[model samples]
Target chain A: MMELDENKKFSKILVPIDGSESSFKAAQFAIAIAHKFKSQIICLHVIVSPQPHEYANLSGLVTPKQIDKIIFDVKKETNLWFDRIKEHQNSENNKIEILTDVILTGLTPYGEITQYAENKKINLIVIGTKGKTKLKKLLLGSTASGVITYAHCPVLVVK
Target chain B: MKEFKKILTPIDGSEHSLSAASYALELAIKFLSEIHIISILPSKIKYGDSSGYFGMVPPKYFDKYKKEAEMWFEQLKNTIKSNEFNLDKIITEVITSPLSVSSAILEYGESKNVDLIVMGTKGKTGLRRLLIGSTAQEIVTYAHCPVMVVR
Candidate 1:
């Protein structure tokens, strides 16, 4: 941790991206905060369940073509997101570090995000909420809410 | 109603609380207000009962704690002075009773009719804050005046 002067503002912010409109809004918010504090932004994206499974008991199948397609799609989308962030970099002189662009083949998004944040020692987490319907959110718990509950640092949930 | 001209900041010697103190000083400098720094002392220090010839600490231990708190306040004052911030007053209150920290701060802020309350966030999250929330959070929710949280 940097030795912070009591009057100094925030110096680092972590933003999670999922390529949604709300996520883009959150990115914008993070940019504003970073500009205010002269802080850097760390952009993160998680790739969950990259492979398909077809099994009733012990049978499973995944074609090479399908795996290649998933990997390519993940890389393409991630690059597009990075390009969007680069657009904002033209105005600020702060150092922006692309900490991690991960593709985790797992089912637990919340747990993975929490673990990554803990490992990184992020100052703050900025996420976007889909504002899902109450019933939908209850059944398929929103990732943003789950992250807020589990995050160790302050979370800003952009609507 | 008259605008608030005085503010009271309670310090616990924690970095979070010191952040609040810095924020309070900034606001005082902006609003041209006075600030009072207060520190409370817990009623008892529970040491083990006498088993051998050596015994637990005497009641005077509480006095020692009060003296230490005053010294901290003085050091804090000197630091602010070095920074060239003029503080109208610095107060150190040693409350030995079992009083709620949030309530004490709120009561003092109200009594002084402060326009704003500034505090620092302890930065607790997840299951750790399931039952016990941060004092800054409690103050923000219950304070009569606008509360600024400095993280």
Candidate 2:
């Protein structure tokens, strides 16, 4: 019984990045869509926090300070990716609005990405077909599939 | 990041596909892209036999289904006309393929060099509660071009 909503608009777009080649390709697609629609793009990078089980073996050996350092380094790397995207945008002379977010959480990457999209009221999600996962044999990465299943809005999977 | 020059949408007479069609039309207008609407009909049907013998459906049923598909295209054409879009920019076709629905759609898209694929999250046969239909999932996984799954 669903009817076409004539008011459909891609005002806000969410683009999740894992600093992989495919993710960068997805960002380019998002930029094009954003340029056409004059929409805002939210580029998010979710870093999964190390679970306690594996670190339990290290126990006292792996101090909280060490964990903080690892998280900090990952955040810095993510920032560099943001800067690269911005540089490309500037070179193109496209004035599309781009926002970057780096989140460290205990939850899964797909869960965090979908949650952020919902919280931001994003109307479109442009994601890469694959991420940094080493399983190259997989045609579709697990995270991409998971996000597609859980997202509240329309999803654009960039190859 | 290629421009959206040609957008392909596969419909199955479902409300979801209809909505997705409308969305595709809107984007097409914005990008000045050619929009192709296709409906895939299965050419092979399995009979009531344990043996793996697949044959074409009855000619009468095929004719009936073809007629229904044409009617759906006619309705969609009316919708496009009402919106005052360039009729030449819109192309509608019904394809009979031996492959699965998703595979047929993917092959058509690739052959046509489609820039983007816009499809519904689920079709008529999809369960209401499921987030995405299997066909849509397969298309997203395997298509060379970008795919937009409209909910």
Q: Which candidate tops TM-score?
A: 2
What are the clashing pairs of model 1? none
Candidate 2 segments exceeding 4 Å error: A1-6, A53-70, B47-55, B79-84
Query: For residues B1-151, could you state the per-residue lDDT of candidate 1 as single tens digits?
Result: 1132666677777666675666566445544567777765433333322332123334597678778778757766655543455555544575543345677677777887876565555532323345224565566556665454544
Recovered share of real interface contacts in candidate 1: 0.00
Candidate 1 chain B superposition, TM-score: 0.70
Complex DockQ per candidate: 0.05, 0.59
**lDDT, model 1, position A74:** 82
* TM-score (0 to 1) of chain B for each candidate: 0.70, 0.87
Cα RMSD over interface residues, candidate 1: 9.5
Name the lDDT value of residue B85 in candidate 1.
Answer: 56
RMSD to the true structure for each prediction, in A, is 10.4, 3.3
Q: Candidate 1: list runs displaced more than 4 Å.
A: A1-12, A36-38, A50-68, A93-95, A98-100, A131-141, B1-151
Q: Could you tell me how far off, in angstroms, the CA of residue A143 lies in candidate 2 after the best superposition?
A: 0.3
lDDT per residue for candidate 1 within A1-159, as digits (tens), equals 122354344456777777777677777767755654566777887767644444122446665666666778788877888778767655666645544465555656667777787887766676665422334333213686567556665555554
